[model samples]
Target: MPTPGFPPGTLDSEGDPIWLTELASDDPNHTLHVVQGLEPAEALEALGAKPRLFRPCVLPEVKPDEWTSLPRAALALDSGDSAALLAGRIGAWTFVYDDAGHTLPHDDTILLSADGRTAASSLYTINADASLSYAVNGEQLAHLNVDDLDLDEELPGLPAELRAAFEAAGVFEIEDEDLEPGEADYAICMRVVCALAGLTGTLDDLRRIPLTVTPFG
Candidate 1:
């Protein structure tokens, strides 16, 4: 069975998620920290004194007639200094094992170019059926394999309703253009995934984690 901590496949027990309060430490590479659960208000309170950032971590649950197979939660973290932080925000959750020179939980993995120019076509599948495919670009990317719908051969702009849905589901943002394709793909996929999960909204309502720093005093 999947554990209740972190994500389904990442931990063995329900421990408070770790928060990095300092950038430098006695052992920067090996340092460990713990964060106890806080209510949304309390979390905001903690952020008042420190440069803390928040991301939603979803608890896993089974859903009936759902197209996606995996259960997931959002993970909010500091987005300023570390590649790991940026990667987490973009939906790539696996950790790199330097010793192994590889990443874990290899399923549905997508790799992005450093400058965000290029992205792999199938880093992750949507709707569980893998019927649709996607390619990323600056304004909007292609959503292919849409066998379920047949409006026209031409790529249609995201409908107002779908756009609204994306926003309402906490997946939309104006800063998306500045993000790399991989990061953009992560955001787009999350919005679509939430839609498939029966959540409502347009992309505009999607909440994004702000880039910030934290200091321990």
Candidate 2:
């Protein structure tokens, strides 16, 4: 058998579904990153993105399934020289979305970027698999392959209040076992990290929020 507190393959392995399954607009090939206590512009600046005014042309009326994806194509560069992101504030966290799938929490300096606060990323691939990573005060607390019910122990830098909330929410896995048909441990793990950083709002809430566009190098 594979390890119990961990999963069988890479974090991107095909296993339990992630928050991206529901968090995404209609596609899974995207990234959502959260930064604590920052405004949208501030968060992008900290991530080393120099955001310029990117006024896209009038978007075509898209089908419901194409709602989010279609808007992103307008943000893409014809030369492919840069990446784009949509950022907005929700509660105490700034949520950044990159339909291009390039974002900070996956970068080499991810931990350093969390020098004073927390940063977390939840990713899902086209293979229909997911993974999570998080850092606090420049220290990486956890990076897990949250496949099925196979998750690591309680996160290292989790706040006491958040821990309490997770406990009450039944977010902690008390045992190690395979997941049921529809159980989503990946989403559960993302929820804990987001809660720890004071992030609130569903994907729909985020999609509806007025967001600023930032250009990523």
- TM-score: which candidate is best? 2
Assess every candidate by TM-score.
Answer: 0.20, 0.62
Candidate 1 per-residue C-alpha lDDT over 36-111 given as tens digits, one digit per residue, 9 for 90 to 100? 2222223223323222543333322332222211111122123222212111122321111011111211111122
| lDDT tens digits by residue: candidate 2, 1-217 | 1212222231122322232334344644666677776787777666666756534233223424543453354454432445556677777777666665666455622643355776777676666456666666776655655564342354434555444434422332324535653344544544544454444333344456666775566
- All models: lDDT? 0.24, 0.52
Model 2, backbone clash pairs (residues 3+ apart or across chains), number: 0
- Residue pairs in steric clash, candidate 2? none
